[model samples]
Target: MPKFCFVADLHMFARRSNAERYQDQIIKTARESELCILGGDIFDFRWSKYLTEDETAHAAVEWLREFDSQTNHCQVHFLLGNHDDHPELLERLPFLEQEMKTFEWSRYYYRLGDSLFLHGDVADKTMSAACLKLQREQFAHGSRTELHNRLYDVAIKAQLHRLAPPAVYPCKRVAKRILNYMDNIGHGRETGIKHVYFGHTHRPMDHYLYQGIHFHNGGAPIGDAPFRILQRTVSLNDGENGLESRIRE
Candidate 1:
């Protein structure tokens, strides 16, 4: 059986990262797992504030490149978060191209067996995204899209509040909506996936079951951020209890 580890929201930057808090844990997990995956925000794009102009991004890219090079025992995969804004940031750093690094960037969710790993924001209607299955005929038409757009507009407006700082619109309601839209009481099950792993909530969630499916969150791994590990139990071949979370002490 292959071992798997999923980490999220390190928020690493050229100068700083919460990695030190759980660096030892990461090394241990990486050494044991067949595959190590970063759910999202491995870099601090928002605070880094270097997403534009030449050298669109900074230190995090080089740091990741070095980290991946050093860790060759298992596959290290990175899923970009809202802050990272995809691999396009690496275009400026020609030396750190994907071809040269051991780490690989995934544009979308990563699927392993019955589990799907995503940045979590994709399911967040409040963060300019939503599960499209909700827009189907079985439900209110255009309702999901409208709400997504409306929330996106709100996010855009919040962008202007940079000066104000800490103006995060609460998104607990959206998370609930996501769970309902994905797997509700009726046959409205969105996907056949048995397990879904997501980050970006900063709240590490354990094995929460909804409609017989498991939802696992990796949470933020920086500052007072309690590092949560998504581990695949070595003895079990079945998917149940696969996401064993190692919550921060």
Candidate 2:
């Protein structure tokens, strides 16, 4: 049986302290698991707009490279999120591009014996209420960059409202609506997958036996909780049969 660690929404940025803590968590988890799966949003947008070649962004990149090297027993898989903009960054990294599997905003199906793992975001909507609130506050304060930032924020919020949550103010409400939609679609699909895991909502939830499917969300690694890891074990009987899934704090 092989064990895996699921982590998502690290949102690594210029904050040196945060980055150090995050690296520690990743290294620690990697040591204990067969593989580490990065759900998405590993880098924050702060470094994208600012920071040059000789800045902290490059240092952060180096940190990731070293972390990859340290985890000999585990392979890291990266699923792309909205925040990850530059493919070149990952491309330039050594030992990482080949070691990581990067997927777009789509479904990923991986089978370990009879169990399946999914970085669920295909049917997920966008932007939490917290994100929207921050945008509104910035706009109200008449911040210098408010106009440009608000434009993009409004566009995203509007799209999310149209697709998932009808209301744009409360992100939790929007997340719930999106989750319901995902559940419906997952149940309708015939993927032969017994367990599905995802992150994007930042809301930690565990629900099994929903229309004959098990659903799990790997919550945000930011916030009060540094990171959340989902652990699961699987076995094959006569070449195909047994699997076990568990979530670890």
Q: Pick the candidate with the highest lDDT.
A: 1
Q: Can you tell me which runs of candidate 2 are displaced by over 4 Å?
A: 14-19, 46-61, 93-95, 98-118, 125-189, 225-227, 235-249
Task: Provide the overall lDDT of each model, using Cα atoms, as 2-decimal numbers.
Answer: 0.55, 0.49
Residue 102 of model 2 has an lDDT of 34
Error of 1 at 193 (Å): 1.5
Off by over 4 Å in 1: 14-17, 49-58, 86-102, 126-191, 233-249
Cα shift from native, residue 221, model 2 (Å): 3.3
Tens-digit per-residue lDDT, 1-249, candidate 1: 667888887766522345667766886787777788887777654454354423435566666666665556467777766666534454533455445545555644555555666776645452222333222112221113345645644654564322221223133443455455334322123434566677766666676776655677766644343556778733334543243321110
